[model samples]
Target: MTSLRFTSRTTSDGVVERDFTVGEVPGVLWSPAAGPDHAPVVLMGHGGGLHKKTPAQRARAVDTVTRWGFHVVAIDAPGHGERPLSAEDEQVRDEFKQAMKTGDIERFRKVSVGYALSLAERAVPEWQRTLDAVQELPEIGTEAPIGYGGGISLGTAIGIPLVAADSRISAAIFGGGFFAYEEELAAARHITVPVLFLLPWDDQYVDRQDGLELFDAFASKEKTLHANPGDHRTIRWHGVDDGFLARHLG
Candidate 1:
């Protein structure tokens, strides 16, 4: 386990938001100022182009701590957030934007998946290292149950592999991501834990069939797919039941 250093601030709502470094990775941990001695922890991942402190991430963190009574943690994916982008990363980003602007679905799909897969490869290992570091924190508790939750392209790309590899993660809320790469689909087969998969019926980036195929690939005996009518970004904020997480993970 890598060593961790933490810096925290108290929100007006009384949640403690701690920023920490686990080796070279930057992450945030959120918890209620007062909670159970050993609250379960949820490891969250942000969408592509977004960082750990994005509005959605912050809202989910606060909701989980105050409403769900769980601690929340999130890390910046490689070349994202505080991490500087490499030349190759910049090129990929430019190409993806161009593809989107030109309405080149094929080009967009190819480049987007490639970019997501590359990030996933690096992000999963960092998440594991982060788990190692966070589990050692006295406030987090070593034996508490851990759940993985995140969405969109990068979050799903990285999270599928992380959940497949880590037995400590007992449940997951997978949203806004699809089976963009073979490795991500393959990883799903190993994820037998309970999963709540959210699908955006009108998602622009992901084909509905592809999302269904990915959901079916999960080895989990208990998995639920909640598909709502909306595009990718809209689905992120709507048409999802919050209580599902508490029910499955609690």
Candidate 2:
């Protein structure tokens, strides 16, 4: 087992928590030590089954972004982070249950992803308040816009909506954005930010046509796709590099 460690500090109104739980989600708020006034900000999300651990996995990504003068708020999604199990929080739990009952994995996915989207939407009001209060950046009202957002596979739940709702988000990076809501929500069509998508061409789990269609339908002219030649889980190993980030993010 990995021994977890965190160091806490305070802001003005509420206690600033490191390895904190704004609600049920596990999160860490990292701020620029020197320039609280002039830093950019990012709201990052984690993938399915992996919570904020993947952010920890991407240590270079986290360290580099913070050094580049952006405050980072990395959050665990509904089920993954510091949340409690409740019958009331049955949407995701139930979706998992229903899928287990029927063994219809695809239906299970839609329900699961949909449930996370609902929770993410519900959580945004409080999250926005956190952004204003904890980070204490230059323009709380107009902090040069949120620069980048992303997650591995399942974190697209939050990433998709954030891109859809806010024009302020400038760039989005997603890996294994597998599910495409063709009927309910057009995932790719709505994103306004320059999107960088990383996926494997041989992914056995994702619907290949749907994935291609979404990539094809990307509404932003700045959108681009990278394909790795492996099953779904190999992108992190074979797909991207630091040079890729430098070219895209800078």
Candidate 3:
């Protein structure tokens, strides 16, 4: 792993928050000052149009670190957060929006799937590099059990491939996302870790059947689907309880 440079600050509650640069990727790490050396760790990814410092992402990280005494790490996804979008990516985004506006599900799916797959190709490797850098930090113990969590389309798109390829992650929370493409489904089949999948039955962007199908694709012997009534944005606030994360990752 390459050398990492980080700046840290401690909150009143003794939780340490660090901002780091691993090569070109920007990330955040949260750890309890007095937590055990071998405490569990969680790797999280933010939703589309969000960054590592997003309120929802930070809240989850703080909860895990302060309440559960776990180490939490999150990184910005490509073309989001600090990463600027390329002209090609911007064009694709515009195309996706137009497709959605026209209610052209086929075109929407095509553009979305293509863009997601491309991002995943870069994202998975970047996450692995971040993990390598994080493990070298003194606050995060070596060989700690790692859990992965994320929400929305970009999160799912990268996470499915990431969890499938990386054996270090023992469990995962996949929510507010769906698999409408062959590559994503193929990637899902490789994830055998315990997974808690959340689906909003009335999600505007994701079909309920598509979400269920994505969950079904997981080869995990221990997988649970929690579906609630609401749209994508609201359902996450309702379905993802503190206890759910505690049970799976704490």
RMSD of each: 1.7, 6.5, 1.8
What is the number of residue pairs that collide in model 3? 0
Estimate, for each residue in 132-233, the C-alpha lDDT of model 3 and write its tens digit.
877787656566778888776788888889999998888988875554578888988999998888777887766778888898999999888887888877
| lDDT tens readout by residue for model 2, 1-250 | 1122344654422223256544334567655445445445666666666756453544643564554655566766555556655564665677778886998877877776676666666555545544544444333346444644566566565666666666666777765646666531475577766777776677756666645676666688887677767766655445354343334444
Q: lDDT of all the models against the reference?
A: 0.84, 0.58, 0.81
Give residue 69's lDDT in candidate 2 (0 to 100). Answer: 50
lDDT, model 2, position 124: 54
TM-score of each: 0.93, 0.73, 0.93
- lDDT (0-100) at residue 73 of candidate 2? 69
lDDT of 1 by residue, 1-250 (tens): 6967886666658688889999889999898888776688899988888999998789888988899788899999999999999898999999999998999988988898888888988888899889888888887767778988887667888899899988989999886555456888899999999888888888867778888888888999999898888777776455567876677667
Off by over 4 Å in 3: 8-10, 236-250
TM-score top scorer:
1
Superposition TM-score, candidate 3 onto the true structure: 0.93
| Candidate 1 weakest ten by summed lDDT | 175-184
